[model samples]
Target chain A: MSLRRRDFLKLTAAGPVAFAAAATLPTSAHASPAPDNAFDDAYGVLVDTTFCIGCRKCEWGCNEANDVPRRARTEFDDKSVTTVHRRPDATAYTVVNQIAAPPETPQPVYAKVQCMHCNHPACASACIVGALRKQPEGPVTYDAWKCIGCRYCMVACPFQIPGYEYAKALQPRVMKCGFCAERIIKEGRKPACVENCPNEALTFGRRRELRSLAHQKAVASPGRYLDHLYGETEVGGTSWLYLTGVDFARADLPPLGSRPVPELTEKIQHGVFKNFVPPLALFGLLGLVMASQHSGENGGK
Target chain B: MSPTFRRLAWGIVVLSALHAPALRAQKVQTEAEQRSHMEMMKLDCRQCHTCESPTTTTPCLMACPRLTVAQSSGKHVVSEAPESMVLDKLADQYQGVQFDHKLHAGMAEMNTSCSTCHHFCPPGKIPACVSCHSIEANEQNLRQPSLKGAYHRQCMNCHREWSHDTDCNVCHLPVGKYAQAHDKTDPTDIMGKAHPVVVAPKMKSYVTPYAKGPVVTFYHEEHIELFGLRCVDCHQKENCSYCHDLSKPQAQKKTMEQVHSLCSSCHQNAKCSKCHDTVERPAFSHASTGWSVGRFHSRLECRACHPTGKRISKVNRDCTSCHGGWNQSNFRHAVTGLQLDETHASAECADCHENRHYNLKPTCAGCHDDKRDFKAVPPGKYVTVSRKR
Candidate 1:
């Protein structure tokens, strides 16, 4: 009875704690102490939902600016709100969302949705051929010929701006909004939509200027603004910024802080895989030991 | 035994003597027979020849009856070589063709003989095309390809394609004359009198054989102003063959009147006064009727003078055809305040007027800055400003 009890105690003591330590041994042996930095100038947009007016003037301007085909119904005089608002389709680079009208206010508030060309844009990073690239000024441009329609960019984009032409039998190209990059940068011309707006609503200027303008407009009009410049700090900064007077949370703008998106995943990834150095060193040591043991066995045989 | 042997020997000697001349004659006969035997028919050699020559004429010929008939048929056969039994055997292994008869015969003018294009055997026998056109092909005949390749080479070759002539009158007429001013090489002009072409007895059936004359008058001057016929209406500036054959009709199925009726059916409503108006017709309310036709002559009606919409012969370069007399001219309006300088006059008027639509306002504001919208603006200048601000 005494001998059996001693054997049982010894078995219990040797089991769990030793196994648990072995499980965590490799991780402790090669811990990455440094944080990674792949996102140099990753840019993005923060759409504040509070200040949108559903006037749809932005839509009209966007269509005109992009030289898109005329819609079957575009009567601006009608005030009926539809069950489904507009979406940014193949031709439209931007869309205006019509939120419920403010109390006692006759007109509804609207918000524009377009490419949130991201800082550390997944689309640019995913492009194997370097077809999609985020420029320093915040617009992502594409080289048509280099794209082979692998659709890796489509999967990579958070906003899902890049669309593929599955219907075209030949010579299909990836289509997306380039934020009027050609007109704004090279020709020094305002975007067509910005230029032809009947209302004093749309404006084209430097990103900083736009932020300041949005802030000033909101501050000056006390009841009019929700006191937020959407693209000022969210997801880094976007070339196209927005201003809204409604609750942004209700406007469907995703809640995100100033941290660039790629950093989140890269932090965990680089912490595990540290430039492949630790794993390679361990492999070399194991190989040396295994070789010596194998030779000894072979000699004995 | 000696006597018997002598008799036998004498008999043998007599027999040998008797047969020697006959053998020699036979050998000579055979040589002559080979030379005389009909072996081949060279079709191209007989293109200009009245009839096919017998194969005895050349040792290189492979005698064939089918080739003989084809060779005698004449130069018009498109396949310059004849089809024989040997050719039939080769055709079973490849593609066979009965080429167009007329075009190939046209090469007779080059004075080429059958050997120039045919496959001849060693020591001058007429070999089959397969013998020279196959994997064991010789270099001399290597350039001459298969039957299909040979035909394509001759027909689609760069040298044989028709192209536009760049000579002066060949494209544009001389100066102001609307119709072709002259055909320099015309045989009628060389004789100083038009001589009627002799209708060959064989070709008489093809000459003006159908009874039909041009149906529509197609008054050119009337259409230029009335129907608004541009220069391209009937006259094309490039590739004349692109529209009309100009050589000969491929079909005699339709009569001339049928063709004329078919063509003019679409253009029946197109006439003078349809687009332009005479003084008797309804006049435009704001049209300048009294303006002098400067540089353009004024005596004739619009349709009578410029019969064709196209600009015709050379006219005077000075801008005085109608404006020379100024206030005394038939036109009431004259250049009272200012006249266009050489540079302005030469510039196309439509460059500033925008499009050719007659409803155009014809003002500087169409392209240049609008002066009326803003105060303190010059009459002819424009100003750019933001509407929103």
Candidate 2:
């Protein structure tokens, strides 16, 4: 009797509404107010693979800038590492892979790979505790404080980015390129990799301008380029774009359809969790049945 | 002036003014001027300037054209260019680059001349890289690389060939660390250093994919010393990667056109057997033809007599071995400086000498029983009256 029927009904009705509001909070709190796939003003990078000489100078600069375990600048002269292709891992946020090119190419094409920084990141969508986030300016960031070691974002990324620190006995971070978000957003400077590139292979600018620049590059040199800008329309677009001389797959970038990965799963799967509505409805039905039984027992008595 | 005269004068002025610029634009260049301009390349001005009238101030220039005519390099000589230049325009983190201009220009003679580095330069003057490649990259014109990028691309195109070592210390010393080193002895340090002699291989034997006689022996020394061919004449547009690539296999895949391009420049009409033979061909020798270019002909170039091409020395040949047109009547004695006497001139030709053996001195045993002292007493008096020979 102390748990009154009116109070319980009110609680059930109000709970789901509050939960729905909280579930939608992350997008408004962190992401750009712009509609999906339209981050025209957001920062972006254009990677021209043809200009990369596999110098590894950018890698040295990045490691030093990010406060990772770094070697002397002169040690980057060991270009033998370029002979073997590599992907970004926990230690390094960005890596340049010397991939096979057409036989006519004088040197093998080098691919600089990092997080694509997707416009609508599936990693952020899949993050259960809201640790992973897509910032308004262009970076898809991660907060270790809220991560809870779920590793769901790892499975969610289309680029196969976001490596985890399994070796650490204590707290391990879900590591990936931060897009030098602090430097870019706060200091208004270029990313260390872009600044250090000898050939200016990595050009940074507004995402919209970069798309046009990539298009112009292909158009200007029709023979030099493949006429396609990867990450432009792939997976609803990305902050990082690539102008490749060869096929995108040859550069280690998988050909993804325009429709985002999260679009397939979010509506149904996330809809169930968005509000406490489904659980509340299920319990409300059960509550109604139990109450009816109790009232029937009282009449029988 | 009459009214009609005034009208005609106005019309003439207007017509000339309208056609003035058009005439200049379509002015036919001379053979020399056209030669300097690579035969007036890029006739369509739109390739360089986007607009109709590109002004000096606004020059709405596109980036350096893709097919930048390197032919203008002929206008530049090593003496006319700067000896050395300290490029400090954009130097910030590192010290200014000590570019050995004369050294590089000297090296350019072996490559495509000054155009090897200075790919685009208009007539009359050579503008510095900063003239076209501005401080920042032209966002509109992605074709022109930024100043920093331009400098790096020019240097690294060759240095990058090392594959392992594009070590910045080779060119860029830490600012304070290097400036003092150069201050001590500025002239001699890398700034004014000359290009080291490129030690070329004596010969290169190519086992080509040709079905008929595959070995193509190129005698590098013979081509240089005997044939008198300059390095640039043959090694045009040589690829640095072709020499520096360490990972590539021994037998690189060159197309048939590419493999033959170097030899075809001089050996255009040469038979395949001249180059491609079962065994390496011996160095060319005039002695093999029973004419040793020994003492008198040693200084003569092969082309002095041979003249190259399909017709081998048929016309414009220097030697005087054949005088088929010469006869007793047409022959002039004073020119040879032994004017014949009346009796000697009246005698039948070949009475004392063979028909074609006029170079030989003959005996006078046929007419006068005396010594054949033609120079002193027998023939005619010398024209100049001195025993010069």
Error of 1 at A119 (Å): 3.1
Q: Chain A TM-score of model 2 versus the true structure?
A: 0.80
**Residue B212 displacement (Å), model 2:** 14
| Residue-wise C-alpha lDDT for candidate 2, range A194-248, written one tens digit per residue | 8888788888888888888888778877998998888887888899999988886
* CAPRI classification of candidate 1: incorrect
All models: lDDT?
0.47, 0.74
**Which of the numbered candidates is closest to the native, going by highest lDDT?**
2
* lDDT at B339, model 1: 38
Give lDDT: candidate 2, residue B97.
80
Q: Please count the clashing residue pairs in each candidate, in the order shown.
A: 35, 0
Q: How many angstroms is the interface RMSD of candidate 1?
A: 34.7
Q: For candidate 2, give the lDDT of residue B259.
A: 75
Query: Model 1: what is its DockQ?
Result: 0.00
